[model samples]
Target: MSLGRYVGRRLAITVPVLVGVTALTFSFVHLLPGDAVDAIVGFRDVSAETEAAIRAEYHLDQPVWDQYLLWLRDAITLEFGESPVTGRDVSATIGRRLPATLALGGAAWLLALAIGIPAGIVTAVSAGKPADEVGRLAALAGIATPNFWLGLILLFVFSVRLGWFRVLPPDAPLVSLATVKFLVLPTITLGTAAAALVMRLLRSSMRRELDAPYVTAARARGLPERTVILKHVLRNAFLPVVTVAGLQLAFLVDGAVVVEGIFSWPGMGRLLVRSILRRDYPVIQAIVLVIGIAIVLANLLVDIIYAILDPRIRY
Candidate 1:
């Protein structure tokens, strides 16, 4: 299929997928045995008038499908509604927190790419013993370990023991060096996982490409090893790697929820936890929709990147 046609089809499919996400997320959040108001009142009694008022405020009295339609309508218009938990506009709430998550996620992905690709390259070049074993070990540790444990270990070693950074100070400004210090542990935790993934993908792809007929012909024709690898191998090897990194980047938004909670970092992941605890349906639904859109956009971006890297795809 032509690139334009492929992109158009993908965009068209996104509409129904987003509607499904909004409806499914809405239904699940509400079906958890309580409404937003009930979660807020904390098992306390409420007057009939108060109950009615709360229901009216959120349009909770409306039918399930109608409520979903209303939320969907507002989302399409970019008005994500208000958070009953905080009385803040949901869109505003997300906008404020989004950058921090993106920053952390970007840092993680960059670090992973920087470290993993080099290790993969080296391991591919030195395929037999020492380098191969070391690279495999690093990848194994990164992949086998859980993020939360890594985060805690980092926190204990760096923050509590060394006095290098806090577990996130509530009053400190985010732009300051102190906040950056606080982000280090969580970033490492997230990056390590991503690094493992990148290394495996790059190594596997490079290994396969090295064995391709074009690479063998180049080597036979007396082309420099570096030129053969760089000119002919890395491009195809990295196409899928780019897409994987993009998908992983999206996870960095919400996947760090546990790490953010552990370190008390002020990011979307932390905000998601708060929204979940309060049973803030609108906030949760909005966040879910935004994440869905981000993933779709990321995949689209990957497709573009692939086309750029492999010109044969242009047609």
Candidate 2:
């Protein structure tokens, strides 16, 4: 199928999935054991009348189906209601916070690409050499390390001991120099594991591609080693890498919860944790919906990239 038709098909599939996700998110969040009023106000501090008023004000007294429909309708029109805990508009809060997450995710993704792709290539080319062994070991270590623990260690060594970075400064504007100083440890924390995964996948993919008949043909045709690998081998090898990177982006967005909390970064992950703790159903639902959509779109983009990279793919 044509690219346009392929994209349309993907998006059509995504809509219902998102709707299902929204419904499930709404239900599960509400299912969490707690009174929303008590979540906002300390238990035993509020009168019955005040508690009833809070429930009525937020329409929490409505049936689950009605609440889901109401939220879905508002969300379709980009009206995500106010946060029950903070009394701020959900849209405005997410709008203010999403950029930080995006910036952090983007930085980590770029770092992973910068470190991973080359490492994979070198490891593949070197095979059983010392460089390969060291790269493989490092990747193993990175994959095994917990992001929160890594964040803390980096914070202590870089931010505390060396005084090279800050330990979660007040929410600075994203994409600025000030934010760069704050992002260093968090980026490393988030990217390290992802990079390791990507590196291993890439190395395996490249090795398989190199053994293919076409690679031998290219080499026999007098192509330089660099040309054979870069112009021919890497292209085919990179298809799986592209898919992994896309999924990694999704993982990074969701996994940012731990790193964001550890660093106290003002992002959707941090907001998500806070909303869950405070039983802010609206915020929780909105964040989950957003994240679900993001993952779907990221996968869609990867499909498109696949089509572009290899002409064999079609709808």
lDDT string, candidate 2, 2-77, tens digits = 7788778877888887778777777876677877677767565878898889888778899878878987888888
Candidate 1 clashes: the total is: 0
lDDT per residue as tens, model 1, 46-149: 99898889789778898888888887788888797777678899988888788878877787888899898898888876777799889988899999999999
TM for candidate 2 is 0.87
lDDT of 2: 0.85
* Model 1: colliding residue pairs: none
Best by TM-score: 2
TM-score of each prediction: 0.84, 0.87
Give candidate 1's TM-score.
0.84
lDDT of each: 0.80, 0.85
Residue 115 CA displacement from its true place in model 2, Å: 0.7
